[model samples]
Target: MNKRKYEMTSRADAAARTADRIIDAMLARFATTPYENVRIEDVAADAGVTGQTLIRRFGSKAALMNATVARELARVAAAREEAAQASPTDTIHELIHHYERYGALILKTYSEAPLVAGLPALAARGRAFHVDWCRRAFPLDPSLSPTEKAVRTAQIIAICDATTWRILRFDGELDEAQTEQALAALLLPLLV
Candidate 1:
């Protein structure tokens, strides 16, 4: 007697689910561990798969990281897009919320950037996203000269940076509300 074969669609779905698990496992490890320190076998174990399975799914470590970055960037872009439609104060709160969730991981990646190839480019992409978001969220003074506008934009970028969030939330030990308030105090003034 011949055994029944699995459905192609079902197999595709199972593959997708496995990929999701691998990405989730990678992120979980990345939350606490540096990029260079993350091991294929460890991540595979976390995802309940073998290292070979991981390679079969993602091809390589860099490829896996690229996939992870794509997923994360999409998530962040969606959140920011929704927040952009809200008031500036609400936008700050949203940014604060984002930073609270992902700030540590962001810092970790930045700190480990030089050790990894393509990290600096990844960081630049992140910075470009932030700059674009800031420009949209806080438009510059139209009356200012081009140089002044550039300076103002830089100021906005600096204020909304993850490092600023680290200072207020982690170092200063501000609660979310207080963090929002502090950020607004500094940023809201520029909006006017």
Candidate 2:
């Protein structure tokens, strides 16, 4: 009986390890490859698992991508929550870092969201996440009217959004530090 239990435990551990490997492989692929271009066979080979195993594990390529995005969102959400405790400038710096880390995957997800079933929901969650972060990172005066608060919140969202990051980093050809400085300059004025 003890031997059987031990065998079951070992099998569970192995399964968990396999799942981790698959997730890691997917995230790595997402870093350098676009969502539409990533092949399941490549992910399976990278994870050291069979393509059939990946299908069995995730059901389909779309499921795999969805799972990958969910995992990344959770990670970013946690980081943002932690950064919320810091000063506003520090939070902006952290936000820029998160964008620099996940910008490519985010852009790909946004572009392919309509085709991917779960991606639109994920994108909505991302927008809410940014809004919540703005609320926490930049507290408004209680005396301000609701409409004014809403407008200011919208501005904060635009300032910290991924599109702004892309324009700064890609179009303006600014490094992360420059991007963070630019965001800080834009955000600090709104707090008044």
Candidate 3:
């Protein structure tokens, strides 16, 4: 019975590892490739698994994408929590680092939300994460009215958003350091 139980545990652990590999491969593909261009066979090849294995693990392409989004959100949440413990400037640096790493994936997910089955909820969750981060990173004045605080929060979200990062990094052709500087210049003033 003990040996049987050990084998069962090992199998479960291996299965979990395989699933994680699939999700990681999907995320890696998402970073450079557009959502529409990402094929399940390619993701499976990248993960060192069969296409059928991906389907068995995630049920469908949409489900795989959804799982990837869920995993990415969980990672972002943990990183945000750790960053929240630091000084505000340090936190901004962390945010910039995250944007530099994940901005393309975030932008692709948002743009494909309507066309993709499960991406709308992912996009909404991303927005919620940004809003919560802004609220925690920039505390409202006790003297301010609720409406004023809400407006300020909205402004902060806009300034620190993925779209803003995309515009600076891609459209403006700024490097990560320059983008971070631009963001800090715009946000630090409002935060104070």
Error of 3 at 124 (Å): 0.8
lDDT of 2 by residue, 77-177 (tens): 99889988998888888989999988767777788778777878988887788788888888988888999999988898888889889999889999999
lDDT order of candidates, best first?
A: 2, 3, 1
Give the runs in model 3 whose Cα sits over 4 Å from its true position: none
TM-score per prediction, in order, is 0.91, 0.92, 0.92
- Name every residue pair that clashes in candidate 1: none
Shift of residue 179 alpha carbon in model 1, Å: 1.0
lDDT of 1 by residue, 1-192 (tens): 233355766788899999999999988998888788899899999999999999998888777876776688778888988998899988998999999888888887778767766667877788789899999988867998899888778888998999999999889999989988999998887776
Considering summed lDDT, which 10 consecutive residues are worst modelled in model 2? 104-113
Ranking by TM-score: 2, 3, 1
Residue 152 of model 3 has an lDDT of 79
